[model samples]
Target: MESLANLECFVRSAETGSFSAAARLLALTPAAVSRNVAMLERNLGVRLFQRSTRKLSLTETGEHFLASIGGNLHALQAAIGAVTTERGEPAGVLRVSLSPSFGIGQILPLMPQWLARYPLIRPDWQFENRPVDLIAEGFDAAIGGGFALTPGVVSRTLAPAHLIAVASPAYLAGRPLPRQPEDLAGLDNIVLRASRTGRVRQTVLRNAAGLESAVQLNESMIFNDPVAMREAALLGLGVALLVVPDALPWLERGELVRLLPDWYVDLGVISLYYPSRTLMPAKTRAFIDFITEHFEREALARRFRAGPG
Candidate 1:
């Protein structure tokens, strides 16, 4: 039988698509991980990975082998972790993906408290703009909006992605303050072009009364990023529809003012996604509980709702 270490090296390498990343996770040198995988393939008398300088891909046989053994390996790790965790706190490298703006502004602030409770657990977090595949990419969890519910992945909603119109006081100095959604048409509008679709994002404003109205945003400046739009608005460029989280700090600091506060657009829910496995890692479970508890206690979901203050 091949050694468990070799199998682990192969599996992690496949998931990360690189020996270096797997090495970081396993605390092994890249050369050692490569050697272990090579040894495993030689023992099996078949090629597993189509190795190259730029990328590594699995062959047909490798794919089948991974499917057969991946679950079993995870179960074995979970069993070991369960036994170990009985002696002390959950400890390991916890790999998680997060949206850049939200993670930095909201979640990162909670880390000090989290670390105080679980000092042994180490966090390896990546701030990304795009949705990540939790299982295939080997992420323990991901926090973002609009991620598709792929097979073997489950999500817990954190907040409604409510969008509200905002502009700097400088921008609104001369222009009339918008009393309603339609009043925004006369002002210069800074807009976001959808990064994935390459088209301008459309907004339909809705209020507490269940009434919806469309606003015609005259694009004076266009951006493919929310941060850029916020900055443009701060520079007195134009009115921009911004997600509540993105607008909250500026709104609180009085750097930007919310317009037509009674109205908002519900884009979707920001969610926390994780693999739907039978035996999840102890570290992951602890992290999830900690984050969800924090959200509830802080009433962040309700705070994220855009309404009259």
Candidate 2:
């Protein structure tokens, strides 16, 4: 508990950039904050902050230590809250970030029941194609693909990020059908350019037999957002390689047809990401458990696994 107090003081000092500011935030005296930090430095045998007349800032070691233990401090606080509260009925605004199509198509549908189950929990969600800084943005959780596992962030696999080629029947009316992976060259293609890299990415398609082949589309059209790319394909513009979960509704209704039915690309895993805390907030933990259980009950992960149908 003493060590925990020292850590809490250090984290607060690091965040606010001074012992006085940390003292104000933690409701302690500036001298006490300084003493706690000094004790921590002695125990760890490393100077955490470089002190100056104008300001104080974390040393290189201090920066790394903060990144590593920041989440655990939060978890410790949350655990204390969980046990201390009288009812502890998970009351809070549950802020989440996720992709548009999947959030709308898959996650959005699950919300009504979830809300009913935990009415005290208010939903605050953002839908985007690109990743956001989960901690900096003050998000409780995020769901998507290709997010770097930075310090204090953890993820649980929700579903496979599988990409399959699709086009409206009108677009392929007179165009050559893609019988093989290479046959996509003969058809009009809608490419997805990485917003960060500004490069049209290549996709590796795999079949049931475990054979893999990479395909590069000749860009008849390019889109930065996955939802827009799928919409373009649905508008009869061209064949677009889209994640299966995003296209499931359209595919099920016969509005979009899968080109090369036996082939799909392994983009990665669609995951639920949250802070890697020693103990999570009740609201965040509840949401995580609910979503995980829902995914299992529906077998959505198995349905979305990469490769042949």
Per-structure clash totals for the candidates: 0, 0
* TM-scores of all candidate predictions against the true structure: 0.75, 0.75
lDDT values of the candidates? 0.84, 0.82
Report the number of the highest-lDDT candidate.
1
Q: Can you tell me which runs of candidate 2 are displaced by over 4 Å?
A: 1-87
lDDT per residue for candidate 1 within 112-172, as digits (tens), equals 9999988888999998778976654567899988887865579999888899999999888
Q: C-alpha displacement of 255 in model 1, angstroms?
A: 1.9
lDDT for each residue of candidate 2 in 94-174, tens digit (9 for 90 to 100)? 789988888898899998899898888889999887897675455789999888776557889988888899999998897
